[model samples]
Target: MSKGLKGKLVLAISSRALFDLSESHQVYLTQGIEAYRQYQIEHEDEVLEPGEAFPLVKKLLSFNASLGRDRVEVVLVSRNSADTGLRVFNSIQHYELAISRAAFSGGRNPHPYLNAFGCDLFLSTHADDVRSALDAGFAAATILAGGTRRAQSNELRIAFDGDAVLFSDEAERVYQAGGIEAFQVLERESARSPLRGGPFKGFLEALNLLQREFPDDACPIRTALVTARSAPAHERVIRTLRDWDIRLDESLFLGGLDKSAFLEAFAADVFFDDQAGHCERARQVVATGHVPHGISNPLRDLPAD
Candidate 1:
């Protein structure tokens, strides 16, 4: 029988997110593909150091040891041509990562394959691919090589930003144009209303399903919603979760506070947010991924408003 992803927790991660390709990336940026390809070929035997999401991926894979089954699947999604990907595969073997599948798209967009793999989450260092994956209705994030921290908890704690992330960018558009006061009024007015599902909603729902597999008190999966909304604004979020029938283990309504210290305390295995500023801040304390979708990232021809 062929292996399938429907019953597993699937993740499609980019080579850049899985391993440190900075030197090679800089070569690609400065010299071009020829040099970069040569560099990768020359260093094919050199194992890669862990990138921001490496630790989290390792921990996630570790769960399989106890489950005695393929409860998780992490697939490599990369822009590297097949010729240049040997180094990455070698590094994966060196690290003994359980990633058995990969999509090498050369220089083209590779995100379109995410769904075929039943990817619950897609993490890449490429912002364009992240946006495209999100637009294509996958839970995607742009992994940054910062805020890689040591996890103190045994549970797989995954945290996410609310607006433009787990929830639609609708409220974010209002806030972006009207500022805090107007946005607060809108949220207050719609306190009873549930926000539309956003890019990461599917991933959250899938994660909840995994949580249900084990006893609540001892589930290996723990999720958090860390957003900038506070008080009167908090009702909609609470109601939305209730409406979705999904329960988050924790929530932080920061309103306007910096999320770094709090996330550090939370010791999140990974944090996802649409805002680069927030991602930058949170990445200093936890593995962070930037969701470059919605109003914040305006495409050349599209109106962000």
Candidate 2:
């Protein structure tokens, strides 16, 4: 929504981020929401403690906003029970920080259900849930296996594409489907038109909160936009970011050139793009993510590694 959240670091933590569950405790989660529902019904008045997951959530949240105020948003999602959401929210509030959003599937199958929340990143128990969320639109991961390690730093350097990452993919979709000729015509016609909100808008707002908290003249979290559009087509991108009052540390409009070099020089920790070619190339330089265009890719249908 803010043109792009290129340089911002977004860390998504789940209820599981606060505590660890034993093998027995994990049985209900594995069984899905039905098992959780039964457990809650049996022990209506029982209150669950914030397991080992709570401290990690606090650590990540604190690291994100360490330089200033309200820089991080902890979105609490639960499928354990209705009461589980309240319990997690209360724990977060105990630290004087509120949960950004809450989502519950009421089913033990957390993967399919949590996918609907549109989290930028997901911290949860299921490894498959992390993969699904990443495949959707968010950079998701499980809390275990070093998922939160890379995100521990406050000074995160992130890269994003302009058209789809920040603004709506409507125009880019037209371009990709119709070709350069049609794209130019559309851009010329829509010179005065504004773009719509993107998947990263809410994530950008969260970063803005971080920026406001620090308010340093220099940007602590560096961001860059490596886009294919140039000159005139770039006006909308600039205007949109300015209008939203979002600040980008760096921006490059490379018309038709490859972006791998710029990304390498920037030393970006992660780069996201809808084009597999771009992500493939950027991966050689940084930890890259291929954002599925919500369109089919005939080439990548092979079984997962």
Candidate 3:
């Protein structure tokens, strides 16, 4: 296992992702949310689940083992109920699901807590939690647009931007903070320099480990980098990946072009970037994640709500 995950495949999933009532399951696990929240407040540690969500958790655990990934680690981040955690654990055992770790949180927000757990990725119903995970240096996704189960084929197609996903956002920060002129100056001076680390570097390492475990000789895990930076800016991105010993199947430096069309062509299961505009467009074409700007990136003006 890579040092990123600390030798564990830590996945932080919301309570809802574990169970789907639309499917057939007698014991509904969704009811215990409020109870679970209360329990957590009273007792320090507890795991809760709604009646509708347990079967799905079992399925996820089975899938994790089948994929050779570590057993699923679930954290109930919802504040709805305290009893939810206990109910969830009981259902997991009742259904004989294999789980590596299970924990519950108090009224505290789930995303920051997830960071403390060293979670590699977070799955949740709340969009804020997803965004928070990305900001906190973790790969995160919400089940809004679609489900990961849909990508159950032998190959999984994943896409990301070059600047802030694979490489550090320092250059982008310069551009945002000091405008195009300052950015140009920095890029020109740093032309021969290597790219720095970004949010998804750890994720790339994890994928490499997975590749070693499950080699896809014919149909490998398809990966791509779609970015707006062209030519001169692109060289640093490529060199950085090479230096880090990272492998990418496809990379497109679009030179300020919209990435939606290319992402559609790639048929990506998931695409990630720090810009909401790109995410807004790509979400229509594929599963998309909006990686929050790192603290170093200048805060752009927020549109009025």
TM-score sort, best first: 1, 3, 2
Greater TM-score among 1 and 3 belongs to 1
Report lDDT (Cα) of residue 42, candidate 3: 52
Q: Alpha-carbon error at 54 in model 3, in Å?
A: 14
Off by over 4 Å in 2: 1-10, 13-65, 68-120, 123-154, 295-305
RMSD of 2: 8.3
Alpha-carbon lDDT, every model: 0.85, 0.58, 0.61
lDDT of 2 at 60: 42
Candidate 1, 45-131: lDDT as tens digits: 999888878888887887777667778899998999889999999999999898889999998999878878888888888878877
Residue 57 local lDDT, model 3: 38
lDDT tens readout by residue for model 3, 1-305: 23333655566676555544222221224445454345434543333333323333344345455666663355555433344455555555655666535545543457766656667666665566666677667776554343233334545677888677767888888888898778778877787688788777887776666555554575346789898887667767777788888888899888888998888778766787777667767767666655655543234522111
Rank the candidate models, highest lDDT first.
Answer: 1, 3, 2
Give me the candidate number with maximum TM-score: 1
Q: How many residue pairs clash in each candidate?
A: 1, 14, 30
Among the numbered candidates, top lDDT falls to 1
C-alpha lDDT of candidate 2 relative to the true structure: 0.58
